[model samples]
Target: MAKAIRQIKQVDPAPEEWQAASLSAVVKAAAENGESLIKLLEIIKQLDGMGVLNAMEGLLQNRVDVAEIALGQLNQPTMYHVVKNGMNVFKFLGAIDPEQLQTILSGITSGFEKAAQSGGQESLWKLGKSMRSPEVKRSLAMMTGILAGMGEAMEQNHSLPEGGTDIG
Candidate 1:
């Protein structure tokens, strides 16, 4: 019984592991060329203008339908990564200007709203095609890692006892 319990409690990759894998993928993709890196930066900047953190919050909240709608605009793996990394970078920079941040956040929220209204996947595909930058690819990889980490964390949280108390 003890062994079975331990097995059930075993960690599957863990958030850190997912993050590492994603970051490694990004680094590998980026090492190919400088132009790709520049493209990635541009994509990230666009995502930054789009309010990544709030979207991530929606994702973390288990608002699946809403999150899916918002993520529609990020169907392209590269676009996904750029926005994800942009959010991470912005979060890390505590001194970012408030007004500028608000504007970016508003734009992102509006973009999500618009995507939700448009019932076509073609736009997302086209956006991806437009973001053919190496840097964007790398950022996407890293963002994938961050998302994996978030998933792991969510899973771990779900497996825990309620009220932050020990079950046993």
Candidate 2:
């Protein structure tokens, strides 16, 4: 029994070692450039824009399901934390009002219904493929530029003096 226990102990990692290994694995996984990562980011951005968190009480609950799907493709903990943090930021910024939240929920429900009626994942993938058009690209670029300008303005406002005196 002692010999068996020793063998088990030899195979099991120490807590600190395990943590380090996990962090290393996450870094390695995140280093990879893959379509799945792009898809994940796109999904997160869409969810943020659509105010998915405001529609759901426990926004992080679906994170486990997302992590499970991403297990082989991504570092589970990193993916989970990224999604959770993104959702938290969205919530913190007050991105969703009641009307917008309801619209997002309705859109999701309608999308699911349409997917069920047509096909399933294949149909959804086709829809996603269709959305990658030039018009969509232009719109995305414009929105990104607008948001970046807003962020820059906010930062400048916060950094400037109250009397707006020129430091130079």
Candidate 3:
């Protein structure tokens, strides 16, 4: 069955109604988050006293041009790469469990500390001896497996993987 169509009409706010609504909103906001709002206003007052607020106001007055200039700057290759890598990092981090990531990161830090304590760099003979340790053997196997998986994923995606680049 087809539903009957009803014509919609727009209603403009009358001055009294708008005033009442605005005042009600202020009251509701104060009631809901009065402490936080007061703290924010106090921070603003401090900024105003320090002349920072007026500087911000002046910048905002020319917001359109400022935004245009910012957009133009962001259009540059370095800025583009910065934004792209930031987004990629966020995406990569999003896929991992926080606890698991912390564990792996701590393990890496521990490995570095242990390596530094032994010597700056091991001799080829020492490296050969170290490689025979079960722990070292296991780590190498795990690292190679992870690299293989990443290489396969890169091949499937057919896109060159990003290397960390800093322009900031």
Candidate number achieving the greatest lDDT relative to the actual structure: 3
TM-score of each: 0.21, 0.26, 0.59
Where is model 2 more than 4 Å wrong at Cα? 1-11, 33-35, 58-168
| Arranged by TM-score, best first | 3, 2, 1
State, as a TM-score between 0 and 1, how close model 2 is to the true structure.
0.26
Q: lDDT by residue for model 2 over 1-168, one digit each (tens)?
A: 344444433478899999999999987887785667889999988987898855563536677776676675566677778889999988955865778667657866886787688665466676688679775566577668967777677667796446644334
Residue-by-residue lDDT tens digits, candidate 1, 1-168: 344434356568989999999999888887877697899899887877898856777668878877787778679788979989999987867666788678657866875786787655557777788468774576577668867777677677795435533324
Error of 1 at 93 (Å): 10
TM-score: which is higher, 1 or 2?
A: 2
lDDT of model number 2: 0.72
1-168: candidate 3 lDDT, tens digit per residue: 998879878899999999999999989989999899989999999999999989999999999999999999989999989999999999999999999899879879999999889877778999899999998987899898987788778768875446522224
| Model 3 spans > 4 angstroms off | 1-42, 49-51, 119-121, 158-168
lDDT of 1: 0.74
Error of 3 at 6 (Å): 27
Candidate 2: RMSD to truth: 25.1
Each candidate's clash count: 7, 0, 0
